[model samples]
Target: FEAGLLETLAPLAGVAVEARVASAPAEKTRKARFDEAMLFTHRGLSGPAILQISSYWREGEPIVAAMAPDHDVFEVLKAAKAANGRQAVHTALSQIVPRRLAENLCAREGVAGNLADLSDKALRRLDQAVNAWTVKPVGSEGYRTAEVTLGGIDTAALDQQTLAVKSVPGLYFIGEAVDVTGWLGGYNFQWAWSSGWAAGQVC
Candidate 1:
């Protein structure tokens, strides 16, 4: 267990591949493809996907996490079983996700041995773990780890083009100080540069 933990940054790395906030039942049941990687930490979960979703995440909110975002987990695994029933479950799963991740899932779920040994119910359980896993975070890692805050000055109160305060002629609100928050990566930076440039142009 010690060696396994040391080998992976996320103990449940592959299991939480792509995650987004799920505040409602419909949202939780729906499928989504996150264009970012999700990482598992001892604290909870993090990564581009989780980080982007964090802005919408509230305390006590549950997140819908997908292990295999690209394929239908039930049908895909069933097909693999039909083609190679004698193959280990982890072997088949590794073909869908990362090998290390498959191994972790297999160990956690007690899913091992040949695919032929697995019943339809077992297959469904495996599919759910990969496609529709639900996770409820205690809370976020907080501002210390937060890349951006959600709101500041209301966008409506400012000039949309110049980012200048509508009521105050010389005052301007820009960057993270405004109510505009963007996705992770260079998006926020780009907004900063663009908004700063716009504000500078007229201020």
Candidate 2:
């Protein structure tokens, strides 16, 4: 929160939702799923899920989010419909997600009235909204708030064993200044320490 970065599309601010996010088909690398806590901020989405996905995300490419990752939302909604036919759709959905998020999702899907009144198709759409919410981020906070960065000096320019600049004798580049980057965790820190140690050995 102190970083004040990674602004996303405005909608579900203040809502905390655990999601399984994955890169879109347009992603440059192999698709990997990031399951973590997602927080809706006043400007956009943040927290672990978004930060992890942002490494693979490019502008204009959509990211798929399984909001209800543990539950089959379609089946849940259908079961709710059967168990309590008179309950409102949003009311039933609130049991799965936050109440405000449920209302917003219901409004977005244009679903209302008793669960029994909703068609299977309508319920399915709502299920999609909850389980497969897709959105393209307009922009990110960039390096100002980035935990790590990509696209530094190419790794090929340096000796793999010593992290020394092969063309420039006695010169070395290590850590974030190099192209090596890792997923969200202490992997980046490990790279920093190991690379620095390698260079420290021979530099």
Candidate 3:
């Protein structure tokens, strides 16, 4: 990291700094690997939707797994409507999700009957339920297994131009310790680059 322009600007900006010695690594601790699979009734896992929601994690939180009957039933309904144009959508959906989920959704919507007996009104209601199924997350595995943490130091305390603390000169915070957190993809790495560059310029 170069320190030409940054050193010149540090004093001019009226900033204070602090430098602390980096700590040594701690003794090795036993770690367990968890391999719990996410399960869903209708649409199978391994898609973007499931992957995106998996990123959220916190300390001591249980690992959350989700299941919904809506999509499965919805697909069945859509298939019925297009195939015979007379089959009950809800009945078809039952074959897709678990029996309990199917029964619960039907009972909640007051839909009853075989494929040939469902009315237009019943079909519409069932259709709506399937498309927007709601699921409750049982829990999520705590931070020990989490990929990332959401919050950090307040970036407002540091000067954006030099990555130095306004109250503490020479002191710089970078990487995940900073207030910045990234979305699922490459965005986080970009933040690291930009922040490190700023700090390196001055450090």
The candidate that wins on TM-score is 2
Q: What lDDT tens digits, residue by residue, belong to model 2 across residues 1-203?
A: 22322322245677999899988856456576899998888767888999988888877778889888998888999999899999999999999999988998898788999998899999999989988988777788877889888789999998999998999999999899999889887999999999999999986
Give lDDT: candidate 2, residue 96. Answer: 94
Off by over 4 Å in 3: 1-47, 50-114
RMSD of each: 4.6, 3.7, 20.1
Candidate 3's residue-wise lDDT over 1-203, tens digit each? 01442332232232111111111112123121222223332222223333344453222332222233224444556567667665554556656544554565576688876655666667667655544433333344447645546667788998888778899878988878887766556777888898899899868
lDDT, candidate 2, at 146:
91
The runs of at least 3 residues in candidate 1 whose Cα sits more than 4 Å from the true structure, single-residue gaps closed, are 1-10, 13-33
lDDT of 2 at 184: 81
lDDT of each: 0.74, 0.86, 0.51
Q: Give the C-alpha miss distance for residue 181 in model 3, angstroms.
A: 2.0
- Candidate 3's displacement at residue 4, Å, is 62
Residue 61 displacement in candidate 3 (angstroms): 15
Which prediction has the highest lDDT against the true structure? 2
Query: What is candidate 3's CA lDDT for residue 189?
Result: 81
lDDT string for model 1 (31-64, tens) is 3335577776665667888777777666765677
Order by lDDT, highest first: 2, 1, 3
Give candidate 2 regions above 4 Å deviation: 1-11
